[model samples]
Target: MEYSKDDLIEAKRQIDSTLHKLKETVKTLESKENVSRLKSQITLAKRRIKAFEIANYFLENEIKKDK
Candidate 1:
């Protein structure tokens, strides 16, 4: 799926929100397995956010070149 700049920004925002919630959940969780799962999810979210950021940078550069 093609994501517009706004969509990518929104996705990054949502992922950050989720990561914060997961961190809070980790603080309260006792199960090592569950904590590990959340940590993995956090890692995935961070990767996705990085991807979005890179895409956004390229997209913006292209737009500038066009102008």
Candidate 2:
């Protein structure tokens, strides 16, 4: 299924929030497993956010080009 603009915006927001929480969790995690998991999730979130930002930028540019 395709995502609407609102959906993308919400997903991006959620990813940002999750990333922030993961960072904090990393700092608080005394266990190696917990730290590792948080780090992995944070990495994934960063990748997702990067992709979204790139897409958003491309879309914005395409809109401008159309005018």
TM-score of 1: 0.48
Poorly placed runs, candidate 2 (over 4 Å): 1-35
Residue pairs whose backbone atoms clash in candidate 2: none
| lDDT (Cα atoms) of all candidates against the true structure | 0.59, 0.59
All candidates: CA RMSD (Å)? 6.0, 5.8
lDDT of 1 by residue, 17-48 (tens): 66566555544553455666577665665566
Which runs of model 1 end up more than 4 angstroms from their true locations?
1-36
Q: In candidate 2, what are the lDDT values of residues 9-47, reduced to their tens digit?
A: 666566556656655654555345556657766566556
Residues forming the 10-long window of minimal summed lDDT in candidate 1 = 22-31
lDDT of model 2 at residue 16?
Answer: 59
